[model samples]
Target: MKSDVLFTSHATAKNGREGHVKSDDGLIDLDLTMPNSDSDKKGSNPEQLFAAAYSACYDGALNLVASKEKKKIDSTTTADISFLKDSEDNGFKIAATLHIEISGVGQEEAEDLAQKAHQACPYSKATRGNIDVTLNPKAV
Candidate 1:
């Protein structure tokens, strides 16, 4: 059987622009908001979701690739995933950068590992050929 994950979630709009979302088990519960000019607005948007998922997926991919390659990574000290919005035909498109730190390996090795991970990451696979994905030696 194929490995799979089952998740359920629901979101409701409190107002015209604000909403809340929670998963079935309540582990992922957060307020959702549309991006606006108001800096004081509270809550997260889809970009945050994309970044979060990408980071986790990339991290898992890194570990899996490293294990297969016989590389030992001591730890992941830091990770930064950024979302960039630019003009698209319909409205806007989101691009991302995933910067992860692998402690046990040197710069070159870390970069190589990240690249391998990107190739294997499910998130990466899903987004492939649709958007402009920059698989930097840095962004897994």
Candidate 2:
């Protein structure tokens, strides 16, 4: 089957220090900037984009799974994604940590939903064996 939706990524100046990405519909557009040797960054980077996508995707997955289980999520859900550069490999590999906060739920309930959402998320499936991802579910 074909995709339900398609996104086009077009970047104007990615080779330079700063660039921006735009989707065909302008729904996904952001400026990207790289950190210099001093570790200073101005605009968002690719890691930030990945983090945002993961968080949004995970949130949607959680919502879908919760609804399927006839559970009501009265509060908001948030994801804190951390991108870690492999020191051993010298940035050749990347590791990620995802902390999901599900409000209006107990720790056990939150964790259960989070685990199910991880299995449901496309991003999670895409990065499953490719990158090391640590998931921490929190009730807040």
Candidate 3:
């Protein structure tokens, strides 16, 4: 069986040199503007969108991985994805730090599950060679 998910965002002009994006879900309303043409602002601009997408995708992937490993993860898994600029180029990097706070699971077991989750996550795999990922777990 195959499944699919979809999301949509639309942009409209806000001013002379700015615009705003509104999604159907209304979870994000972002402003599009140039921080500076030759500064670090460009790479920093699109981070919020990336972070939001990465966090949600990683969590879902983690849940699947945990299930496959016969582990249970409830509503306490948290993820923080930070976008950092590459010092050598005019580009950016991603740092995904995941915190899974669950009961009835040991640190070793949780860590092992998390490693599998990271490997299974589509976003993590897609950006593996291009980005940085860090997983942190807190046992409850």
Candidate 4:
């Protein structure tokens, strides 16, 4: 197997438990705030980061799958990712919804291609059985 390119990032303290993340390639600039237990300000935490990453990765994977299947997928594909709270664990949960508007494909073929994409997508495979995912195709 060929070696893959490695990426590195560092997080610096912004102020009082908050920080900013910077990648070595200068590509990412993210401000991170810790969850405040006292104030109950737990929104936009790590779960949101996970959701964004998973959603983008899944979309790219879907595009690659479509290309390999000789299907045309353009800018019409939309993906929404939701991160919910796990009541039992008091943690976060993830759910993904995908809508594709590919032209010249029947519903059955589109569904099959989507299923294949879901299986082939790395993020989908990684989160399988852990998160709820919904795939909808607007092609007919």
Q: Give a tens-digit lDDT track for model 1, residues 1-140.
A: 88666854464434443677666567777777876646676887667766777878788988999899887775342333344455555465666666677777777888888778878998889877866666545322
Write the residue-wise lDDT of candidate 2 on 62-121 in tens digits: 989989998878434444445556787777565667777777679999989989998999
Of the candidates numbered 1 and 2, which has the greater TM-score value? 2
Candidate 3: where is the Cα deviation over 4 Å? 1-18, 24-27, 32-45
lDDT of 4: 0.67
Stretches of candidate 1 off by over 4 Å are 1-17, 75-90, 136-140
Ranking of candidates on TM-score, top first: 2, 1, 3, 4
Instruction: Tell me the TM-score of each prediction against the true structure.
Output: 0.74, 0.75, 0.66, 0.65
Q: TM-score of predicted model 2?
A: 0.75
- Residue-by-residue lDDT tens digits, candidate 4, 1-140: 99686854464434433556555556665666655446544334454566667667766776788788887856245567665788879997668787766665777777777788789877889878987888887664
| Overall lDDT per candidate, in order of appearance | 0.69, 0.75, 0.66, 0.67
Q: Which prediction has the highest lDDT against the true structure?
A: 2
lDDT measured at residue 47 in model 1 versus the true structure, 0 to 100: 70
For model 3, residues 18-109, the per-residue Cα lDDT tens digits are 45655656655566555555544332245555666777777788778777777876625555666568888978666767676656678887
Which model scores highest in TM-score? Answer: 2
Q: What's the lDDT for residue 36 in model 3?
A: 52
Ranking by lDDT: 2, 1, 4, 3
lDDT of 2 at 125: 97
